[model samples]
Target: MNQLGHLKQFRSSVPRKRSMGRRKIEMKTIDKEPARLVTFAKRRVGLFNKANELSTLCGAEVVILLFSESGKVYSFGHPNVNSILDKFLVQNFLPEENVPKIMEESVQGTKNSQVVKHEIMTELLSKVGVEKKRGKALDQQREEETLLGGEWWQGPIEDLDLPKLNHLMLSIHGFIELAMAKANMLTLGTKNGCK
Candidate 1:
């Protein structure tokens, strides 16, 4: 019996470790009734604990409503469920005295929305005007080059005056780039189902 033989014997004699810990479960609707019921109970307790903690820490009113598998209603609320429900109903439903105040708020909201719509329309119109101006400039430049008896880009760059050549190059490049960007944006918008 050498050291290698003793090591081999010890390895063979040792028991394999078994995993006894809880595993991470995938979230989905449970099909088995008994398992679903057990999970529901456990989750309900955890939910109540979280709600209680939130209410205590924030000094805030909290309410939760749930239905069990058997269709029984379960509710959790701080400072009672009925009081919270009554408060919600009163605030949302409104008494006759509060009707005028609600109407005033609604009117103000409408006016604010109208102002926003007007501003957006104005901005869109300004962009359209800029595009129209650019289109006109490009058309004028093309006509001028035609009248000069050939495409400006086709003519020898060294033959033209430096200032005129610089102006032509800048105008053509700027217009073409802007137009291409606008075309690309329009194409993307249509592809994405945008108006």
Candidate 2:
């Protein structure tokens, strides 16, 4: 059996060896984000490729989620990625207290998105002096379009089927309105509580 093939298979796994032995390699802690980011990028690509190959060769499913030292996430998998992760999460039941607070804030902020959207639209409409009837109609059009799913600005407006086109427009308008409204309420609540 050729052991060389295995070595070649995981070339990145070979740690850099010290040219001189006996004395431990004096290493300094990494303090720079750019340097850490570059190292992370190189290693992440290598890890992802290895995972892909392992899955292909062994006829086994594989999924890997990596958190870089600086706190960025990278993941790779064969078959369904989220399922594997969900299972692990359920099994572990571990709290990620070490994860940066900003990531948590971003995730939490995205919750209750529709209300946030509506508030923003309401504010914009008010500023622009748009009539409530027109706003409601626009919101309705955007709502329907969102249910269908697609970017509205890309295609020819006239070419779309009347029903589908109308749906898309309504969805966009509705999404904005919902998000804006939710945001306004959230902001107001936060302010009131703070006071």
Candidate 3:
């Protein structure tokens, strides 16, 4: 028997530990301070490594800003942090001092601007969308009216179905309402209602 064959036989004698594969971490706040700090340190290093890889491999500008619970700051930047921040500030407004404030009012005022701007933009967009839908409905109504050839009252009504006759009756009521509203306005305007 060879020494190599004996070594192979010895390897087959050893047991392997069974595992259920990698587990997905539940995304929740870590209540334990010590574990959280350790996790932060590990994750921060990994994040920085990824950022460095992104810069080196893709030749892209990368900047990361992180604030720890202890008010410590951690940052990763390609080339420099200041240059990227300056470029960002040129595009968007930022405070004179970028430090976090303890004052609720001061911090809230800054935060509120972004929230308000987003809310206003969303509101205006919804209004414009509603206006567009209303315009489209009006256009469809106009097209349907055009298809019926100008005026329904002037068109042939003898061939119309019961439902169409009911619709025409409603339209006639609408016209009566309009005329009455105009008459009422005129009545309010002058001594004599109509002359």
Question: Which is the leading candidate under lDDT?
Answer: 1
Per-residue CA lDDT of model 1 for 108-164, tens digit only, reads: 666554354345458768977997897798789779878978675666878778866
Rank the models by lDDT, top first: 1, 3, 2
How many clashing residue pairs, candidate 2?
31
In model 1, the Cα lDDT at residue 152 comes to 56
Cα error of candidate 1 at position 85, Å:
1.4
Candidate 2, overall lDDT? Answer: 0.62
Residue-wise C-alpha lDDT for candidate 3, range 155-195, written one tens digit per residue = 68897779668767766776796797687656533532223
For candidate 3, the clash count comes to 0
Tens-place lDDT per residue, model 2, 1-195, is: 489888787877878776875676347655798886776788689988987886676655678879776677677878756444333433232246523432343345554433533454476568557657767876786687778885565788777787766767776887897797677657644643431
Residue 76 lDDT in candidate 3: 88
Per-model TM against the reference:
0.39, 0.30, 0.42
Please report, in order, the local distance difference test score of every candidate based on alpha carbons.
0.71, 0.62, 0.68
Off by over 4 Å in 1: 1-22, 94-195
